[model samples]
Target: MLREIYLSTALLAAFGLVGAGLVALVHMGTAERIEANREAATLARLHEILPDGEYDNDIINDTTVLSHALLGGGQHLVYRARRNDEPVAAVFTVIARGGYSGDIHLLVGVRENGQVAGVRVISHRETPGLGDDIEASRSDWILGFDNLALDDPPMERWAVQRDGGIFDQFTGATITPRAVVRAVRDTLIYFDTHREQVFTPIPVDPTDEEAHADE
Candidate 1:
């Protein structure tokens, strides 16, 4: 009986190890494909917000990280768009807090002159029919932000119309639209304050240094 118990324990341990190893192998196999899909989705959103042809450089490769309270206080990726090496616009992946259900993820593009290029909702948990109108597929409301600037609306009028602003709020979901409006405004302010830093070139890699040294 003692020998049988030991054998059972050994088989269980071996099975556990095999299961773990299989999981690791599956993860390793899918890792690149998963990352590639994520990158493609992100690039699609970027193009939707910033538009194609307006940028010549590889926007995905030319990016910088920004962390600020206005940007939801977490490190956010800022993709800079340029034509012929001149800055065209900067697209920010920002988080909108205070949503009705939860946070709303956004992609806001601002031109070099401070005007808003466009805005797109990357993801959100707002009410399907009401707050979901903030999405381009659901409504044209998001397009109202195009070409707007901090001064054009006088900044204070950036809120939803219910709050004495130029934007509109969903009939049954004011919090979600309000949250998105505030977040977009904050993102513009963040970009305005850090335009220079946003466009700053990324540092060289050590591997590149080694390759150059080889020459």
Candidate 2:
């Protein structure tokens, strides 16, 4: 009986180790491809936001922080677009949490002058026909936010058409579109307010160097 228990335990351990090894091998093989795909996608989105010229990579601080200008949700990735060593605009990922089903990720570009250059939906799990209209494929409604400035007597001009503003919401899907509009508006406002801080260079901490060395 003792011998049988020992054999059973050994087999379970061996199986567990094999499973872990397979998972590790798969991850190791796929890591590069996954990273390449991510980089390509990021560059494509950055180009859409800043179509004029090339941009160099700029890192934000270590702490993941969201902008208050975000309306429906928050800011994710922030990149500073540059031309001739001068910062032209800051592109950041914004999310709209009030989508028909859930959060809708959006890539937003705000110029130094506080105008929205462009926006693109990165990903979402919204309903097929109804909420999908937020995508560029279903409709060109999302493109309407391009070149909108945050000036004038009031920024209320950026609201949805149903709210007596410039943008138009989907026929039946008002909440999804409305949330996106608000998010874009808020992002622009946040950019205008935190222009200096966002454009500043991120300082590298010495502790990070030690951590990397340990790795």
Candidate 3:
């Protein structure tokens, strides 16, 4: 009995070590490819948002913790769109809570002029027929927000068509769409308020500051 237990324990330990080694090796081998794919996807998204010229930096999260942008001005905005040295986009992945069914995931593009360039629905669990219309594929309703400026009108003016506003709300699913609209508006407002801070480079750590002071 003692010999059997010892053998079992040794086998388990060996298996655990092998499993850990495989995991580490897989991570090491795929890290570069995963990063490259992320960079490619980010660049594609940025181009879809700007589509004007080539950008060099990955300025995502520069404006907001969850956002990024490419920082050159042309006919359209060009953001370098990078993560570390790997290129990516200056994009925001926004989560709008309070939807009728639940939360909605939206990716919103903000132009340099503080206008909304476009919005894409990343995911949602709203009432299928009623709330899904907010998606780009189901309808063009979400596109109504494209190029809308914050100062264009009052908050009341941002409601859906059923509520007598510029946008349209689904027949029975008003709350879900309404939540998304409000969230988008709030995000834009946040961007406008923090534009300069978002675009600027993050401050270096205190260690760097102390080194400078010493110098």
Work out the TM-score per prediction: 0.84, 0.74, 0.67
lDDT of 1 by residue, 149-189 (tens): 98889888999999999998889999998998999899888
lDDT accuracy of residue 146 in candidate 2: 83
The candidate with the higher lDDT, 1 or 3, is: 1
Runs of candidate 3 with Cα error greater than 4 angstroms are: 1-23, 52-54, 60-90, 204-215
Any idea what lDDT model 2 has? 0.75
lDDT per residue (tens digit) for residues 30-117 in model 2 = 9988988987777766777786444554422222345553534444667776656567788777887777788888888888778788
lDDT value, residue 189 of candidate 1: 87
Best by lDDT: 1
Model 1 spans > 4 angstroms off? 1-29, 213-215
Predictions in order: lDDT = 0.91, 0.75, 0.68
Model 1: how far residue 192 lies from native, Å: 1.5
In model 3, state the lDDT of residue 208. Answer: 92
Q: Ranking under TM-score, best-scoring first? A: 1, 2, 3
